[model samples]
Target: MDWKTITQIDRRYLYIILFIFVSIPLLSPLNLPILVGEHAQAMYDTTETLSAGDIVVCSFDFGPATIPENRPQAKGFLFQARELGLRVVATAFWASGGPLGEDILRDVYGSDFPAIPEYGTDVVYLGYIPGNEVGMQTFGDDTWTAKGTDHYGTPMADIPLMQDTRAAEDLSLWCEITSGTPGEQQVIQFVQGRHGGPAALPLVVGSTAVSVPGMMPFYAAGQIVGILNGLSGAGEYESLLAGAYGYPTELLAPLDAQSVAHVIVILFIIAGNISYVLTRSSGGKEK
Candidate 1:
């Protein structure tokens, strides 16, 4: 057939329409039913186990690239800590994480939830510490000495929250939300390994989906307590946070839109397959 005839036969417009159809729903979320994953449930359960007056170290080990997946996990953990009246001490290894960490704390305690935990008393930001494994080692050794000042250059000793925090052992629990290389290994080698059995403190993790497979080894070894991986995991956490702490309905719209977009994508895949088979069986005829 001529190029003109081929152009007439081709249904490229269908593909274009499907793309827009999928994109629109994503841009405008639907707030569909959320099914919790086993990993997320474990993280949630572990977080709930914490009691009032406990201390949790939130180590933001990932950069801005992972904010979408890692941010919600941080939110869930922070609120859980605050709800139980637990003291939170947040720090980061990645420089980019500084802003991301602040944004998360502000988002949860600032507006959507709108119940700011007592800043100096309830939760405090230790900011970004430069050294990777060495930093983790030092932190496990002495919290204040390792990080002398908070993110804003305020002395840790002056911060009421940092008063009792000396080492990983002093904290009730520790969570490392990591994406790339250093933090997870650092936690395993320095914090989890350096400290004895119960003194080691429970370690929870939030990582990208691609990193989850590699992270399982640590989980199986009983090094890490819990894990939340990728966007799906984040979505479940968002639902959980919204349920326990109540999110603005507007904030959840994107999650619903994602659900609809996923269905639309699946439908397009099945339809494409069926069309391919029918076209092949009809001796390459265009109908």
Candidate 2:
């Protein structure tokens, strides 16, 4: 048996296999178990502390580029807030994030049973605040002073929810569904940092996978109470919501594909290593 052949499986074949693996779950979710992460748990727990009618700042700091990860993260939180009767202040910092956040908000808040949530009272949209980190600082200091209008071009004064929000301090929680710029770091420095340490307003981050490592120190320092780390974070938070509050899993289809793809990749790696070892034992030279 030419052991070398095992090491030379066609790249196209691998691609086909992976594509099949991913497609199967995407088409029909396998209900794979997604173990909850500590960061996700922290996010859930921090949110649980707030009471009904408490205000939550749901900042969609990601754009279309990060929708795959941030969409479910935002949706899960929005669902939770709606269920618990928490008022949400939906806004975005990234220019593109504005419309994207509006869509997510619509999906979660749209209801037929009791009619859709009242826009100005149940949730308020601030659209996209420009200036990145500087914009965050300005908005954090005084919400309406920087942007006198909400997303709909309606004057802030017309929105009753705006009355409760003069600054970040007036809100109960800061949830940054972020990808970059005015993301976790900016929130830590400008939003959370503005308040007193130890007694500062609690924050949660729904970050892209790559950004999670850099944000961990802040999480450890207690500056951030919870983190939704990438698509997996969304899955974990969704799972918790499904289990604890009996909410249906909205991202299960994508998450099942993600889990299957990961498993397939790992199995291939193990097979490759075993083949390499056998080849070495058969007098094959290592490259």
- The best candidate by lDDT is 2
In Å, residue 37's CA in model 2 sits off its true spot by 3.1
Best by TM-score: 2
Q: How far is candidate 1 from the true structure (C-alpha RMSD, Å)?
A: 4.8
Instruction: Flag regions of model 1 displaced more than 4 Å.
Output: 1-22, 111-117, 197-199, 247-253, 256-287
RMSD of each: 4.8, 2.6
lDDT of each: 0.75, 0.85
The pairs that clash in candidate 1 are 29-257, 30-256, 30-257, 31-256
lDDT of 1 by residue, 1-287 (tens): 23223323346766676667656656766556678888877777888888888898998888877776788778777777777788888988887887788888887678532134477787888888878888888888887767888877878878888888888888878888889867676788887788874345888888877898888887777777778877677767667766887743333554655556667768756666666666667666544
